[model samples]
Target: MAPLKTLLLVVVVLLPVANACQPPRTLHVPVFHRDALFPPPPSAKRGSLLRQRLAADAARYASLVDATGRLHSPVFSGIPFESGEYFALVGVGTPSTKAMLVIDTGSDLVWLQCSPCRHCYAQKGQVFDPRRSSTYRRVPCSSPQCRALRFPGCDSGGSGGGCRYMVAYGDGSSSTGDLATDKLAFANYTYINNVTLGCGRDNEGLFDSAAGLLGVGRGKISISTQVAPAYGNVFEYCLGDRTSRSTHSSYLVFGRTPELTSTAFTALLSNPRRPSLYYVDMAGFSVGGERVTGFSNASLALDPATGRGGVVVDSGTAISRFARDAYAALRDAFDARAHAAGMRKLAGEYSVFDACYDLRGRPAASAPPIVLHFAGGADMALPPENYFLPMDGGRRRASSYRCLGFEAADDGLSVIGNVQQQGFRVVFDVEKERIGFAPNGCTS
Candidate 1:
């Protein structure tokens, strides 16, 4: 009996030391495609889902390329939340209220619909009421978080002189409310205190039924930046196949992971004029072992002065887009190779894809492989499904048609959208200023 008592005392003392020596564990939040949130009715047509997604992708790309309508905030400008692709569930306030938020990498500012709304859009579940949370507090106008706003506002009531914010999106969606801090909790019970966010009183847009938007852009006010101190200045995401709907889920990871060790890294470029977007140096491209002609590295170079003529990696846009001339070259090369492989081309454009193939009788394996070459010899060899998106042929077969998943931009600014990034673990190490990619990372 005395020996057992001594052993118990030893364990009680050693447990604290063991826990103290343990390293920080990474937090993984499940991410779902927007389609998974509100699935189409059973009566919906076969090709309707793909068509709707393509249309939304076009709107998102247009918003990114427009670069107009810059708001008072450094984080605002052409952020079309209506066309956002993925979303995640988050908990707000002290009691932890669940809210579904769109996961966007194009803009900054984490905001959500709050109670006592003047004009709020329809959202699922209950709206976050700060009054119910003990930890909720409105930020003062003189606070550092308020001053961080590019253009801060003071309320008309001026009762307590609290800081206010107004953000406008390219698609006419706007959110106006008080800047406040509260406890933010994730699904794994990982919570952060004193996190600054917008409690939108008046909000409206094509947000579908989401509670709000979660921005992971490069701005200082971005969620990624706000949590950087505790989680490290690193974040990563692995987008699963959207067609699978809710059956499979990838993670939006915060902090370091074992997968980073094997990833191929490239220098993350930045444009001082437009600092919120992630830019990269693209060397060129290849189609079936043949180098594409016409466009050079100089063509894809970023003009720092104007913040134009560069490539951006975005998770909101569904399909990748290149400069008009560069895209023409890539399309022609891909078409030539596809034709040589005995694939028949369909006339006219299918949504945003121009080079579509009639895959009624053809196997998906026959499609040529496409590779994107970035700086530092980091090449992303895309699988057939990554570059070729299959569509439903209605009453016939779902895989009867497949289209090239790349598009041409009106301007020189090219975008690498989510379609090309599926199945790869894309790491944004902001502190190190480098982006890393590891193939087949979703399985982990």
Candidate 2:
């Protein structure tokens, strides 16, 4: 009896030490693309089709925002463009199934196509059968969770039945379904039970192959917020390089304290119009060390009243978009440099770009570099590899069409698209309200 008592005492003392020495909870998952979701493959040298899709989505994304905010209840969509290039594998339901979820930092709700579907977009794998999962639980409309989503007071289903949700994007894409709580499994074999998410039934529009969305936005119901209790208030993602043509997957890291070696810093702001988006301050822009003129500081400030002039680091957008005035300056600067180098202009081209160069005579490596200067000493340099693309995109041999990667937009908001973000690790620190950037993110 005395020996047993001594052993119990030893375990009680050692257990605390063991746990204390353990590292903070963390999650890391791979993010990669499967295939081109929409029709018309990307242009080899210039991603015209890709740019169109992203720009259209960005426009719609800006329009749908009310600027009134969603503090009381969350209302947003993931992969609202009807297509997504990259997705993350998320395990949902009991006896977990690995579901390919679209990655969208612009949204906050992590949704999945649930079983007993009435209407759903065609997905790659088997639909999640809630009946098979013991952990599956439908949230009632009266529940606090449902109420917070503004439940809409149930539907024709019943007065006190499962909560229903509907989110419509500006481009007419929408998801109508029930709100429920289920276990979400991650790549690290760690999971959280009763993670509130939308179990979409009548999901419509152009979502190719993705079963759902992994919303990593700045909202109360976002997956980042849901897991913040255990993982802390930090997440980092290193978008893999598209030029490498390698099979290595990019990564998404969540931790209590983000590990960063970057000296640059930028303040994350808030706008009532777009509450879920991660807004950051952009002090100014510089093209090869030349500051843009007529681009006032007020042009890019966040304003809910006007519903314009804000910036977000989005994972879904492929290329970067700048305000009309700002883009004109940037375009002229880049075009002037290209013209000085004796590059020929491709005439008779009807495209979204203002400057399209005929690169058949010169390698894409010859293009000049551009830099986007952010607040707090963050200067993101865009090498030829980051902004220049072959018109043929290696689709065929013996083709020479390389163009600069940039676009003009009428919207007041500016975006740091995924293309410019490639080859770097972008850290979204909501706790500190700052963003960090580091090179060589894939291996880091």
* RMSD (Å) per prediction: 9.8, 9.6
Q: Model 1, range 348-438, lDDT digits (tens) per residue? A: 8876678988765888877888889899998888888888888664634546678888888776778887778888889988879988888
List lDDT for all candidates, in order: 0.72, 0.64
Q: What C-alpha lDDT does candidate 1 achieve relative to the native structure?
A: 0.72
TM-score of 2: 0.83
Summing lDDT over every window of 10 consecutive residues in candidate 1, give the lowest-scoring window: 1-10
Candidate 2 lDDT over 354-406, as tens digits, reads: 57777656877777668777777787776677777555333444256666776
Model 2, stretches more than 4 Å misplaced? 1-24, 36-84, 150-159, 243-247, 256-258, 304-307, 348-350, 393-398
Top candidate by lDDT: 1
Model 1: how far residue 313 lies from native, Å = 1.0
Q: For model 1, state the Cα shift of residue 154 in Å.
A: 1.1
